[model samples]
Target chain A: AAGVIQSPRHLIKEKRETATLKCYPIPRHDTVYWYQQGPGQDPQFLISFYEKMQSDKGSIPDRFSAQQFSDYHSELNMSSLELGDSALYFCASSPRGSGRFGYTFGSGTRLTVV
Target chain B: QKEVEQDPGPLSVPEGAIVSLNCTYSNSAFQYFMWYRQYSRKGPELLMYTYSSGNKEDGRFTAQVDKSSKYISLFIRDSQPSDSATYLCAMSVPRNTGNQFYFGTGTSLTVIP
Candidate 1:
């Protein structure tokens, strides 16, 4: 079975720089969710999309934006990055846009802002 | 108050011992409960999930949910060193909302040989 795929397994950026993180959810999965995990902290919900439409929002920063395309892949765009942005970014997917069941998560992207 | 609460335990137990993990939530609307095991630097892998209040057993793992108490638990039988990892409990509501998942802080367990 195909699992959620995240690109740029590791990233390093200077403060004020910009970056983009990509996610390819499992095939046929229509819902995508983004989460940020600080060291020793639980994953925090950022944003989510269903069927290419923004469905929910959480603690995502104003400097960050995300969207899902028709192919079911999603991108997280961050600008004017700060040191606090350094964390692990995870993407999860569920079938038929229903998290009522559960989600399948990606390996995650480790972003380090200096 | 936070939506979910769990003890972050660096628990150590001997091999072959039974391990128990637990979490509590404040939301009464949460109808689905799940437990995930995450290895260092890896994604969280789903271990078990239960709807409403009941006990579901799979292999050596058992998951229990009590809606009335807003609590959930996962029990591991005959633990092994490989089972040493962080266990996170998660829950979600029905389809009316975004149905996003809320997670616990996680408990780290180490099985000694």
Candidate 2:
């Protein structure tokens, strides 16, 4: 079975810099999701993409944006990063829009904003 | 109030002990409950998922949901050292567009050998 994959497993950026993280969903999956996990905390929903369109934006600020190129790929962008932006960003995929089977998550990209 | 609440504990237990993890939610609209296990430096892996009320068992893991109390739980029997990880409780409400999930802060477990 194909698993979700993320690029740039570790990243370091200065404050106010722009950072982009990429993810490839499992083959045959339709919906993709992005989440942020702060140190010692659970993952927080960032955004979800379906049908090549942005579906939902969570409590994240506008400085964070995401895009889905196709059914199998998505990207998360953080512009003008702050020290608070430093966290582990995860990508996940689901076969359908409903909550039938839970999401399969990627290993995540560890972002450090200095 | 936050939709979901969980205790973030570095709960330590001996091997072969049973472990109980739990979460509570304030959102009555939440219809799906899930438990995920995340190892250090790794993404979360789905362990159990339940809809609404009742209990579901798979091997050594059992998941229970009580809609009346707005509580959900994951019970692990015969816990092993390999089972040491963070357990996250998540739930979602049905929406016209898509389901959005709310996650708890997660509880870390350390199973001593």
Candidate 3:
């Protein structure tokens, strides 16, 4: 079974720089969700898309933007990064028929801003 | 109060001991309950899931849901060192246009051999 895939397992950036993260959800999955987890904290929902359309939003910062492409893959673009933006970014996918248990997460991308 | 509450315990126990983790939520609208295990530097993986209420068991893991109390529990019997990880509780309403998940702070557990 293919799982969600996130690019740049580890990322290092300087404050005020920009970065972009990519996510490839499981094949056949329609919904993709993005989450950010800080040090020793629970994962916070950032945003979500269904069928390549923006479906929901969460605590995502104004400097960050995301979009799901026609291929069902998604990208998160962050600009003017800050130290606080350093965290683990995770992507999860689930098909429409699959319930909440269907959420399959990828090996997250660890972002470190200095 | 937060939507979900869980004790952030660095619980240490010897191997073969039973491990119990718990969480409480404030939303009655939630119908699906899930438990996820996260290893260091890895994303969370689903461990158990329950709908509505009652008890569900799978091998060494058992999950109990008390809808009336808005409480859920995960019990690992005969725990092993390999079972050591962070446990997170998540709850959500039925799947709809915009399904959102509420999570607890996660409890860290360590089982020593």
Candidate 4:
């Protein structure tokens, strides 16, 4: 089965720079969720989308924005990045109405801000 | 208090031993419970999932839910070194709009050979 796919397995950036991460959810999955996990910490919910529409927001920073395209893929754009933004970013997808157990996560992108 | 609580244990045990991991939640509305195993620097991989209450077993893994106590557990029998990883417990409430997952602080386990 096809799993969620995340781009740029590893990313390096300097403070104040901008970066964009993309995600390709599993085929037919209509919900996409983004999470950020710092070292030794649990994954923190960033934001989520359902069917190309904004559905929920969590602890995402003002400098970051995301959107789900018509293709069901999503992108997370971060501007004026800070050192604290360095962490593992994960994208998960689930088929609508399949319940919570349907969530399938990607390999994740490791962001390193210096 | 946090929505979910789990002991962040760097627990070590010999292979073939039974390993138990647990989590407690304050929300009574959470209906779906899940267990994920995350290797270092990797995304979480679902290990077990259960709805409502009772027990569900698969291979060497078992998941138990106690709705009345607001607690959940995952037991790995005959553990192996390959089972060493961080275990995260998550729960969610079904919603028409979207569902948000609450995760507990992961427990790091190491099974020695």
TM-score of each: 0.97, 0.96, 0.97, 0.97
Q: Which stretches of candidate 2 lie over 4 Å from their true place?
A: A98-100
Candidate 2 clashing pairs?
none
* Candidate 4 ranges with C-alpha deviation above 4 Å: none
lDDT of 3 at B18: 95
lDDT, candidate 4, at A76: 100
Using DockQ as the measure, name the better of candidate 3 and candidate 4. 4
True contacts kept of each: 0.63, 0.75, 0.59, 0.57
Computed on C-alphas against the true complex, the DockQ of each candidate is 0.72, 0.75, 0.69, 0.71
Clashes of 4: 0
Q: Estimate every model's Cα lDDT from 0 to 1.
A: 0.93, 0.90, 0.92, 0.93
Cα shift from native, residue A43, model 4 (Å): 0.8
- What's model 1's lDDT at A82? 100
Candidate 2 residues A1-114, lDDT tens each? 779999999999999999999999988888899999999987888888887888788867899888999556998889999999999999999877644447999999999999
What is the lDDT for A42 in model 2? 78
Which segments of candidate 1 are over 4 A away from where they belong? B95-97
Q: Residue A60 CA error for candidate 2 (Å)?
A: 2.5
Residue-wise lDDT of candidate 4 within B1-113, one digit each (tens)?
A: 99999999989999999999999999999989999999997889988888968999999999999999999999999999999999999999867677779999899999999
TM-score, candidate 2, first chain:
0.94
Ranking by lDDT: 4, 1, 3, 2
